[model samples]
Target: MKNSTLGPPDSEAHELQRNLSNRHIQLIAIGGAIGTGLFMGSGKTISLAGPSIIFVYMIIGFMLFFVMRAMGELLLSNLKYKSFIDFSADLLGPWAGFFTGWTYWFCWIVTGIADVIAISAYSQFWFPDIPQWLPALSCVGLLLSLNLLTVKMFGELEFWFAMIKIVAICALVCTGLYMVVAAYQSPAGDVASLANLWNDGGMFPHGAMGFFAGFQIAIFAFAGIELVGTTAAETKNPERNLPRAINSIPLRIIVFYVFALIAIMAVTPWRDVVANKSPFVELFVLAGLPAAAGIINFVVLTSAASSANSGVFSTSRMLYGLAVDGDAPGKFKALSSRAVPSNGLIFSCVCLSAGALVIYLVPNMLDAFTLITTVSAILFMCVWSMILLSYLAYRKQREHLHRASKYRMPGGIFMSWACLVFFVAMLALLALEEDTRKALVFVPVWFVILGLAYRSMRQKKSEGVQLSYDAD
Candidate 1:
């Protein structure tokens, strides 16, 4: 509503509108970063690192904090830069933009499917007799409809989506504190203690293997952390709001992750949780609540739906930016009557529709989920690596720009090198994990494909320039 724009130049003169406020940006970052993965897949994280999983998340959080700072500083450099890829290009090169933009787009598409699939699975909690395909289809139709209304509507929806997560997490932390430090013993078991986190099998219960193992899975939970940066163009006060989102989002994620994982492990012990099931849900059951499964089931289902909602919003926004930049199909560049990039929103929803087919068509559910996560992580790694590389290039090639920056990165290239190394190490860690190895395979293949695509686009541009010169 507040940030709508007029029609695409190619379309009937129109406007594009989006009603995202600074409040919305903060919550979107909160909601997007704290995904269903932490709620559902955290069980696996607990199983891997045991209690040490908490430490793993903190470590990754620190690395990504620096990543966000780099992104924020880059975004602040130019108010007109709508797309992160634009900044990537300005900072690094056209190749960086080409790779980062497309890869980031690809990552969300994969992540969106996972969210949709998870949404359908969550729906099964309340409707055991209903077919999975129906709910998945219904969800796709529903979110698509909501996004089409207006940009403000999208922001409003995200606000609620984020509110749900924030509320649930706060409640969980309060309840867990009552149970742990308050020493309130539930009917089902012994009282909890902070000691449970360290004393049960010790802090490093799973040993170095488990400690390393947690990194492979934990990184994926942090996938949407950059959503705040993506919204710089849309925000009314990028200088103020974007920095606020970047500063607070990481700390919130770390708290949510470390506390929630600690609570789950304290109640059930890492060994007691089902490898395939959600540990968040199990914490309620362990607390001896009669409605544990249903309550948590509802919460996680909402979590998945919330994730889908965000994936659609961000992907469409990215497409809208690329379209405006001549990086994507021009039609997708068109604005809505409401000033939102309605065309790109529709395009992303069409892709999301494929989730319905997957509801019933997969060969195996876990296998399909694993493939999706692997690809998402690989693509995300590529996008993140580009950001770091772009920052590195920016510092060296644009010394004047760096000195001119009001929000220059501290230690400058020093932090840039650390972040890049961290990104590469994450890719390597993905390769080492049996659970995440396919990600390694998919990522390089993606780079090669992007390379070819970039080359083709360059050649076309060269021809276009030559033809224009001849005409002149």
Candidate 2:
């Protein structure tokens, strides 16, 4: 918001000042890019692709990097880009904006539920006797309160949350590297080598099917990559800091996923990397490190909590935005004294509390988590499609942008089309797969709900206009 504005601008023009510092923006980007999916699901991926899983992550990372670059370009072009939804609506038309904004809200809301399940389930690993619902409820309560603070406070919280995750992963990579070197001449008599990668019945031990199955698990690892774009509204230096963060996507994938996975595989063969356990903590134990399980558990707990915090933050902001646009109850847009979207935050958190109830009813959390994750992934796809549509629209209407499109997605229009095709294929694949098929059913239901909500909002708007005209 400009200093000249007497108070906040009109709700539609309600700008999020670039108050987030460089460090906060960088860490927030990382925090969003990494999630519980990496630590909890990595072992499952290892089982699917053996050591070849690293290659799967690399491929996904390359594609996602291009996507982020495209988003960064559009956001950079317009200082008024409140969020991706604003850009989407302004460029891709009203339908695109409505779908994108609501779908993103669903993405985080579902993801938050999944994180709650993980948090409760992980807590059981430490305290097996405790009721799962108890921890889930408690965590939901804690993070809900934390997120009801100012946006700057939220940014600072994410900063530390991302820092912890970064430190944990880097330490794991470094420790794994050391273990591999040490294992070469150790008494176990297994010379630590890249050969270990193939020792478990070769790289494609499970064959072509296994490689394809890699996507099943690998997709979860890339769950939050789009999260970087969500923070554009809050970044301190959107032009400078965002480019710095977006450019690092490729490097992070290489360093954290590819090289780190290689280091772990070199030390321990795929056969020994137990599919049911965490590959991260398992590496520490393999290296003969003490208390590795506890350490990893702490990191995962904080990771889950951090994500929940963000879920509350993003969903609230989106809802508040919608409310201002007359798409939701006017009450939701009201700010607390701290300038926090307190009402919206509470609303989303209360919805997230449903996880605790579900856990109480169902013995297994995995089924619920999987279904929600699929829908969340689909929602994220919708958000991405909106982004591409926005970019495409912006290119046609705005002539100046054409002269300076250096960072255009590779293959230009072709890659955009390719990505859309890939997303459609992904949806089809979800139906083909047992775990993700539920979203095929659920996503359509979500659109129906959104359609009804839009109609109701339109009715309300028309009535308001009529009342004003009568008074005039």
Candidate 3:
């Protein structure tokens, strides 16, 4: 396979290596599918939407699956393209690449900050006396050291992290199923049964508005679903592995998200779930298993670390790509002996430390988390929308390529438009909540900054070209 075009021109020494194997790719995709948002944020989602939160996850997963398929087709169409940023630039314009690349980088950075805050909060579960920022900064330091070692190291870390999450979810589902069969009764005198889903107040107990409110946080839970697209440059056999990973998204969502959520609501009933606490932990505690609650807390702690690790890996690679494309500083183009972008990694970690500052400022963890995640969700939607837009552009300009391709996006241009509309609807949903609406107002400032930066970049390039012309 050709080296990724995002790599430095004319230098094999600087190219990102294709070292991630099939297992790594599969696990990474799985890790991305299950994010910290599900473990930590689902309680709020349940409280807001009642049992209808299940439908929220399903709808988001369904729409995002199409986004992944579109991305997979585009990345596979040109072997040299590394990530969505590359193709967006090619199929759309330089502005699209700049905006997508930086926005995506910013998306992860914002997400990493959220993860840091989550780690701090989870650490408090085990060590209540420890200062919050202590664990947050320590988590960032550990991930940076491990990531600096090799790309495979990152894969191995994610692989194990995902395994923990999978095992926890599986155990939760099994436990819930057992409870349902035995007609297990919780301490609150509520019986665990499938009927619990609607027996109390019906599925849409919160009505349409509550159902709509669920979208705000549920959308955040799926933030990293497109992450596999970022690993395109490093994945082995992109033609084989990429398609396998993308195709399995539906099943993963059903098993991990839908089934796991069903288990939570069935065990405790939606009405009794704590809005500010983890439903996974609460489910275990409701079943009178305090030990399992503690273990689930540890599981969530690792889940937060997993997400931060992913954010670190992706952000660095994105900066490297932007640098190679002349949209970022030249130093970020440098790679370590391991072919990892050390400069980008360090820079991202530094940005991640800002999470500690946020914690100090907001004081209220839930409010801070809600605001940060909403911002992340909004930026991630922008990146996802760009992928759809790029797909639409590809179908229009490269009809021959589409016809010749083996893995064409299902529903093609039509689904692309549909997904775009869904994202717009999600933005409207974000406006319904006070915290999320505050986030919506903050997001425009970021775009305005990017707009000004892009214009400055263009003017400099034009001036340089003019200088060369005058000398000639």
Best by TM-score: 3
User: Tens digits of per-residue lDDT for model 1 on 39-146?
Assistant: 767877788788888888898888877878888887787676665777776666666666777788778878888887787777878897987778776877788888
TM-score of 2: 0.92
Question: Relative to the true structure, how large is the alpha-carbon lDDT of every model?
Answer: 0.75, 0.75, 0.92
Candidate 1 deviant stretches above 4 angstroms:
1-18, 182-190, 359-363
TM-score of each model, in listed order:
0.92, 0.92, 0.98
Single out the weakest 10-residue window by summed lDDT for candidate 1. Answer: 1-10
After superposition, the stretches of candidate 2 with alpha carbons farther than 4 Å from their true spots are 1-15, 184-191, 404-411, 470-472
Worst 10 residues of 2 by lDDT: 1-10
Return whichever of 2 and 3 wins on TM-score: 3
State how far residue 209 of model 2 sits from its true place (Å).
2.6
lDDT of 2 by residue, 323-435 (tens): 65555677876777676778888988898888887677766766766666677777777777777767777767885885575545555566677777776766666676676
Rank all candidate structures by their TM-score, best first, as comma-separated numbers: 3, 1, 2
Give one digit per residue, the lDDT tens place, for model 3 in 110-229.
Answer: 999999999998899789998889999999999999999999999999999999999999988888888889899876688999998999789999899999999988888898989899
